[model samples]
Target: MDNLPDEILLTIFDYLPPRILWSIISKVCRRWKNVVSHRVITMWDYNKVLKTHKGVVAIFGIRHQTSRQSPRGLAINFHTLNIRELVLCDNFPLGEMFMKSVHSIKTLRHLDVFTLQNLHTGYLPPPEVNSIVLNNNIQPGYLLNLARRKELKALHMYGRSQYYAVNEMSTMIVIQAKHLTHLTLRCPEISDPRWLVFSQCINLLQLQLYACWSVTANGVAHVLQLPKLQVLHITGSRMVRITALMELIPTLSRSIVELNLSASSFSSQHIALLAATLPDLRKMEVWRCDLTAADVLQLASGLTKLEDLDTDVELNSVDLMYLSEHPALKELRCLYEGEIINDELQAQSHIHVRSALTAPFPLRACGEGPSAGVLLHAHAYKPIDGVTLTI
Candidate 1:
């Protein structure tokens, strides 16, 4: 072990958890210490280490005062390490000095921050950052600054507490629309006028909207103009009528591959409309929508390309038996209010069946916003069908 090269030792260290790497491996020798110091460590592990060893600023080449009240508590030298991603959780101190230190890191490409406050004062991300996730209390002008960056590709902003300056937000979207491929917004204030700005974003592939109640049929009509859109999710948007959706189905039929309308009211006609119009859909989620056993059968029969189905539609034993023998379906997730069923269907038909008291929709995690995991690892982002839940 002593004669091993640094490269071989680093490879071995990759398999060990951060706890062991920090507590045991780094203490072995000065050579191992050098390699470990430069290793890519997650912010979670880094925070845990800081909590375990309080007032130890020299560990990762960060020099700081131990005093909690000190204005300049933390100062990081970006030259000492290769930090590629930065995630600032709600627990982390978002003091001015700390933010300044974070801004100096030129290698950062992805940033995830939660519960940002007082954004009107001025907060700018690193120029090189290409993906960003901001949650709660964001200002429109601050978003405009981020949108102006040419490198930005994915932006996810969630919070209902934003200032309802529609014009500023619309301008920001128009500025960055062509560059962004993945976008998610959860603001109730954004209505038809603001949504119309998204029509200029001709390159969008994934778009998710939540709680935009003012967005009526007119707004959705403009959004459907995106020629490259493949994934569409419209949740909690009550103003969007089913008739409007039916009218616009043909516009998105060819490009759309994944659709989620969990909060919408659905009927047999709606299901039949989707099956008839969108033949390329592979994953469909309608958990909270009204659906029946016959509607499910219609979906299974017409949508031959569906591989994953998540719905709240109640099914009898006969319906389950028929679904088990579905040719294309590999996974089924449904809500069951009563006792959990045995894996008899799964065993018989080789389909993975998951049941829960509530819908296992992947809208949000416990304390985090939508797609928190995907936002953290946004450098290699790929659209997933549905996030699995452990029942």
Candidate 2:
């Protein structure tokens, strides 16, 4: 081991986990310490290491801290490390200082700044950044400036402020509408004519709106005009009027593949319309919607290409038996509290059944959009344990 060159040693160290590399390998020798210091290292909530041709990129989750004190010596110097993506979650103490230092990095492309409470004043992404996900209480003026950047391709902003700046947000959407392919907004104050601006986003593929109560059927009519939309997720919105959904389904039926309407009021008729119009639908999530067991069965029978289904409707043994025989359905996630007697059926079934008291899907803080490699490393799905099935 001592005879190996620095290049070979660096390559070998890249495969080791962040904990081992930082604690053990870096202490072996002066040369090892020097090489390890130059590698990608940052504070994260969990230990995730991604190995690339250049070197190892370590993603560490930031632990929640009660005090305002920042972690000593943990501030990232972007000029030294070649970080391609950075995510700052809620309760991060050094968010402002850290964001200020990010301007030095030349390789950064994706930046996600999410804060539920703490507001990082004067926070802004550098000019090179193209994809941004913000869930902070930032000023609308800052967002207006961000939208004017011609290189911006993806923008996701969650509503956390008491006042919604409709004019500024509308202008932002209009400026970048032509270039953005992925856009998500959670504001509840946006409605009607403002939604008309979205029609200009000709290249949009994925659109998610959360808790936007003011956006009625009329507003959605405009969004359906996008030519390339494929994934549409509208949760907790009062846009479930039957007539509107039925009329809008056909416009996106041929192109849409994934649909999530969680926490919305969707009836049997809506499900029928979706199944009939959307032939290519593969993933559907309707948790918290009112649907009978028969409606679910009818949906599974109609959508031959459906592979993933998430719902809150309780499925009896017979329903489980029917789903077990489904040729295309591979996974079913049920968010039910009561006991389900399907032990025997589950043992003999090929479909994976998971039931939890609560929903497992959380609002992702980072690792989505164009960077496939980073998304895989940051947001890999972990299955949650379900309640014990009896009989």
Candidate 3:
């Protein structure tokens, strides 16, 4: 039924993102299914392949499996698994057991798991019983060893605050993964960064810090050592103590070029200090945080590299005119802070600035991580800033 050469079709299919290809193929007739499932098929797309597993299919997509206990559980072919990307998601009873089984896949280069929180260093399987282990905080040394392996490239973990001891427990586990280029932590209510992990990963280029425990002045200072890092994300920081930022901002302002301090506050000194020090910053985001128009004036006044700015405050035509003409201004974001932010009496300052930060990115080449799209979307703004809030 096909007139085209096999090689041509294979090449076109190979370029498709595995996740998308799998979605279409899985719905076709049975003969096609058998061919597509073959282990030697060279292009095993496990991106969304996790969804196709019988374990996931049984729960009907709503719940990931706690374990592969059922006789109907689909067997995963290690040869077919592209170990470079693995997702170990748990939805039920034996989650830890399932993750432990995945740990055995030796060729694994990237492993992403969403598991319960723990107090020990490295990744921990379900809670263990024993006062002796708990009292001494004895961790299975294997996890730290896992962290040190030379091959692992990315690691992501999220857990409940009740199970974590903050930084005291995680520091060694993190530094051990010396080759990791991407790291994400979603634990909330952390009090310190001592166990914060990731010190020797000299190659680390991207980091996502969401609802992670707060950094003390010392913790903030420690972040300055991450010289190779390029992108930063700080969310859910209302609980963040101001003292920690006061200590941390001076060190961070100069080093990071892309800063995302959304939903947090910075003092007058921090705003002013960062404004002058961060000469290299290319993009910035400030959302739902309390910073007066004056504070905004102080922080953003000197940032020539800033291309996009987002905040939850009001601004008027005068305020718009000043920012619209400012030397560094390109895109402005407002979050309808009950009333617009810029005032009439003080808006004329930017009438002559005319900042030219936004440039053209073809978007033909995609970014390396998840938030890459957001960065591209941020560029689609101008200082005659737009405001929208989700209800």
Report the CA-based lDDT of candidate 2 relative to the real structure.
0.63
Q: Please report, in order, the local distance difference test score of every candidate based on alpha carbons.
A: 0.60, 0.63, 0.44
Maximum-TM-score candidate: 2
Q: Over the stretch 320-363, how does candidate 1's per-residue lDDT look in tens digits?
A: 77887777888777655454345675467756766633432243
* Regions more than 4 Å wrong, model 1: 1-79, 159-164, 337-340, 356-391
User: Candidate 2 lDDT, tens digit per residue, 30-73?
Assistant: 98887876664545432222222234343323444332444322
Task: Name the candidate that leads on lDDT.
Answer: 2
Pull out the clashing pairs in model 1: none
All candidates: TM-score: 0.73, 0.74, 0.53
lDDT of 2 at 104: 70
Cα displacement (Å) at residue 34, model 1: 19
Cα deviation at 138, candidate 2, in Å, is 0.5
